[model samples]
Target: MSRPNILIYMTDQEQAQVSFPEHPCLMPRTEQFAGEGVRFRNAYTVAAHCCPARASFMTGLYPSRHGVYNNVNTHTAIHRGLNDGVITFSELLSEAGYRMLFSGKWHISNHENPCDRGWEELIVSSPGDRQSGIPPTARWEEAAKVSNDTRGRGQILRPGWGHYLVYDTYPDQGPKGYENDRDYQFVTAAKEVLPDLTESDTPWCLYIGPNGPHDPFNIPERFADMYDPDQIALPPSYHDQMEDKPRIYQRQRSQYWDQLSEAEVRESIAHYWGYCTMMDEMFGEVLDALEASGAAENTLVLRMSDHGDYCGAHGLYCKGVPAFREAYHIPLMARWPKGIVQPGRDSDALISIMDIAPTLLDLADIGPIPEGVAGRSLTPFFNESSPTSWRDTLYTQFNGVELYYTQRMVQTQTHKYIYNGFDFDELYDLVQDPHELTNVSDRPEYQDIKQDLVRRMWRTALAEKDIISNPYATVAMAPWGPGIAFE
Candidate 1:
């Protein structure tokens, strides 16, 4: 019941379905530890993009509250930082006398690094990399040159724009070790820090973030070869064609992804799954380090991802304008050997990634996170008590990935509705068409359903004080306006 050491491992662009007990993605470490902790089957990110979702995780507030809805990287950003007066949970931990150590990606805000938020930065993909002072990795020179057959399977050549490659092998890698990879470097740093943590008197918190299995699923040949593309099958939704969905969804497909032949699509999935396997291996190494540190029995180990990847679902690669569940559903797992009553359990209770901040504070017996925060502590789910007051609806507040489009979503167990201010709206019967192959927003029978969802959307949007919750005559779009919430 005392303060426990916190060890967090957050991956990038990984979907929640992959961590299901029945999922096909091969993750040996996850499988081994499957019953050692709790697996949240309904976990989700508030936004699909990294910065907004990560900010939600760090602050327990949605993108609108945190004021970051797009990528916060230096080169290609519009709104490049979090809103003023934002307080990350790390700052609270630091005030409570915990040593916060971090390595790998921290895209929450480009204005300042994790150190500015209370963490001691460490490793190659250091949190400091988010700041403009750090040099970016050189890719322009390599992308401009005319390519031959030397291009890897993942490479998508662009004459002017930088070449897009999500999967590739390293020159230093054969089949055994991956010394040159960024993920390995980050994990190694976390591993090195674990030993020193055991000697310290302070209850510490260490965060390891790896930008992998994300895009350009770069890995060794050994990992990619693990899944034969021939045996892989396309997603059930791959043939949807998006004829019933929004036009922007169709445009995204036709412009970029639809070019891939069925063979290529299958190959892309194989590479993504293989990259997942590589991530699992890297995760195991950190767990091994924790075991060696002699704090394995008391440390609170967490495995989560910033958001989900399309990964060939609906003929898309990465997360973007789409409102598909493949892009929003995220993986979250937790293990606390000395604290949790039962190590092995899966909870179907609805939960958000933002809930992480307050959950940690609750577990540590620290003061609750700032009032008015969107996320409530998930302590009941962790304890397997399933609080009766838990929320049923999970909402998404998205602006855009890089482009600007105002969007909001509200989803229940059986139905989902997306309010897009840019174009049209969307509604889906999750029970009837689980793959989201059909859009029911335009159907006469579903009009009532749409209205019901719209009312809920407005209610939550108003409560959250979302930026898009405007009453302007032109932008106050949606078949049922904000006034419907009162009706």
Candidate 2:
């Protein structure tokens, strides 16, 4: 029997709050996949931003260890991609005689193309709004201009309050009409190549990356109108009383959320959901192609997102500043019928997206994961019995971007503490304030709890040799409370 093929479907900035058993309106194919597999309830991204999070997925190391601190494409200060010295899971898979195919957004490395990273057939999308010197709406127009298969009538650029620009396609033809969209193009490319993959003798790994539901809050008309904007409910933390929180919390709210009226916020969220539905349709197309090509039976399929969007949570729009569950927690699900005997169960495992690499290698039986890799193999969790040594806490770090901020978060099942190296820190009693509206870090009553978390964070950083140790170690390592200074 041949080795199991690996199929990874990744989305940019998709939050766990939307997929299956959460927001059930969209992503039917995704929901079906989850029904037949294992879903990780508490999977998180190492960093809240894009580039670093994607880098972490590629290499099993944190941002500081990987040496790509900020977003490479957007940040001028960071020119480095995944360090040449680090060995990626893909490199290991390639060496094991697996054929690799990559299509869609390749943001992991700036200088080296995906071809250099073990992919045999690479179809890279046009650079996004930030990279291209054009109106963000031009992305849609560029897609239409280049593809005869696209049914998008035209691109719509609607300017809102604070000069907020929305990019969407005027697709009168419904979901199938978005064939010209970037994600559709990417999935179509994958579908076209599936036949050859099934016929080939060697096992294959196909990585599908789509940039959607991330921003611009624009999608084809069919999807945008799928849910009534006025009927959409507000986020639980919509009215975040910013009292006692870090100064950046209020600043972020004022900068990003203060400009929108209630109606605009609703519409923006509605479009975001629509974009997710569009992505769902595209995902279905790829899944259909896989089944049609007879490769679905032997394929180990995984779907996950790099970080998440705020989606009006805490009165915020995009990711940045004061990391929280809305931005850091992501959705991770995997389905491999042959390897996983028991499916359709939710595992509340404290796992990081960085663990994906080693997990895939384990499934492929590729063994002896390279040295210096900081992630753990998730193969055991796929079994019926939970590992007694499973981790209880997860650590996430962010080193500033867009707004220039630094934050370290240590989270457990009940409580969470964030150490913002810039202005102030935040602590949340998840049981009391699940939405994380109130910051109890500076509160007198929670001082001891805060100190204990800080000590745990310091010890974890020391044991793990986290990169933030260089500057903040001396201060964080000192006698707990007095050293860090709560109030």
Candidate 3:
């Protein structure tokens, strides 16, 4: 029998709920994919930013182990490169005689490129302003300096307004123009690659990662008109002031909130939804191509995102600080017609993006992941016999000096605990405080609850080796605090 093909479809910054039945975004194609597969309702990204989360997904290890802790950090080998001796899922599959191809964004390294890491073919975008038009050498040098800032390291700087030329093709500028155009090009690339299928004897692993619905909030004209700005509802946690919360959260709100008005926020969200819808359309084309190539039934399809976007939720504009569900929880759907025992079922069990590697290996009937890989295979879940051991809590961490400093969180089905090394601590019963507006950490009534959560937080850190000693332990909050206040 021929080996099964694998297609991992991913989006940059998408919230898990956007594809939910009630979300404002109409994703009929995605909904159809979910209906044909198993959807993981509580899936989360290990880290709430791009690079680290992507690294974890690729390596099946936590960020701390991989050493790509933030988006701006440039130590690519294990830091920039995949950690020394670490076996990437793609590398393993390639060694097993599979064709591995990577298309779209490759933010893993400043020095080493993704193609060197076992991807036989690569079509990618560099980090930073997508339209800067700077040469790779100059762009890397400039990016390195900017990332040296205490907080900016390891994060992709927001793009400025201009014509974005994707992979040196398709110049897109202005609202409702660039994002959709880029999606069109991505779809076109996938279509063009289909002819290669017949020439190869080995099965393939194709990763299509689109950078959309992430920022610049642009969409096609028709898609932008899908929803009225006035009809969009702001999240319940959208407070005018951060009040009694961590100082980092307040700082971030001040920086980005003013750039948008109430109407603009809604419009941005509507455009974001439009971008997601466009992504769905692009994915549908890919699915059709798979079927046309006679590769549909033999291929395992997995769709997910790097991380969730805030997109005006909790009075915040983007993802960085504030590790809320809107920023950490992401949509995950898997379909393997040859392996899945049940279709169209939903699993609420906790899972993370890192699990993708092991699951892929499992579907291939490969042996255990080399020792040291932290993620577990999800094969048993698809088989309808729940795994004997599964994680009950999910964790995320962020380290940004400008927006925040070293914040970590532990999320369970009923509650969430946020530990900020710099400022106030927070705990919330997600069931009672779904929006996470109320902080129950200091409340006397929840004292026992708080202690239990703290223990879990520490346990997770220790298990994942994510803990770091406070380097600035002596710095107290100055009366006025440090840095210029926007307000």
Top candidate, metric TM-score: 1
> How do the residues 1-487 of candidate 3 rate in per-residue lDDT, one tens digit apiece?
4567888888888889998877868999899988888888889998877787888898888877776766533211124435576667877887777788877777765555556677855467654323344332333223223321222211212211111111011233454344436555665676678768645767888888888767656556766666776888877777557677777566455533544566666766777787788788778888888778777777888889999887777677557566778889899998877767778888989998889888877766677787767778887777883667788877665644322355667688988877665566688989998999999877898867765665565445445544232112111111111111111
Q: What is the alpha-carbon lDDT of model 2 when measured against the actual structure?
A: 0.72
Best candidate, lDDT = 1
TM-score versus the correct structure, for each prediction = 0.79, 0.75, 0.72
Instruction: State the displacement of the C-alpha of residue 378, model 2, in Å, after optimal TM-score superposition.
Output: 1.5
What is the C-alpha lDDT profile of model 1 across 1-487, one tens digit per residue? Answer: 6788999999998877777768788887987775898888888899888889989999999888888877676444566777888888899999999999998888877667888899998863524343435222122223234443344455653332234565565543645547678788899889998988899878999999999878877677777778888998898888888888877676556645665678888888887888888888899999999998999888888899988888778777788567799989988888888877777888888889989999888877777568658898877866764667888999888786432376788999999998776566789999999999898988999988887887787667556644343222123345554444444
- Model 3 is weakest, by summed lDDT over 10 consecutive residues, at 478-487
lDDT of 2 at 82: 72
Candidate 2 lDDT by residue in tens digits, 99-153: 9998877776666666777886556753333255433222222322332232221
The clash number for model 3 is 16
Error of 2 at 349 (Å): 1.0
Show pairs that collide, candidate 1.
166-216, 166-217
lDDT (0 to 1) per candidate = 0.77, 0.72, 0.67
Error of 3 at 464 (Å): 38
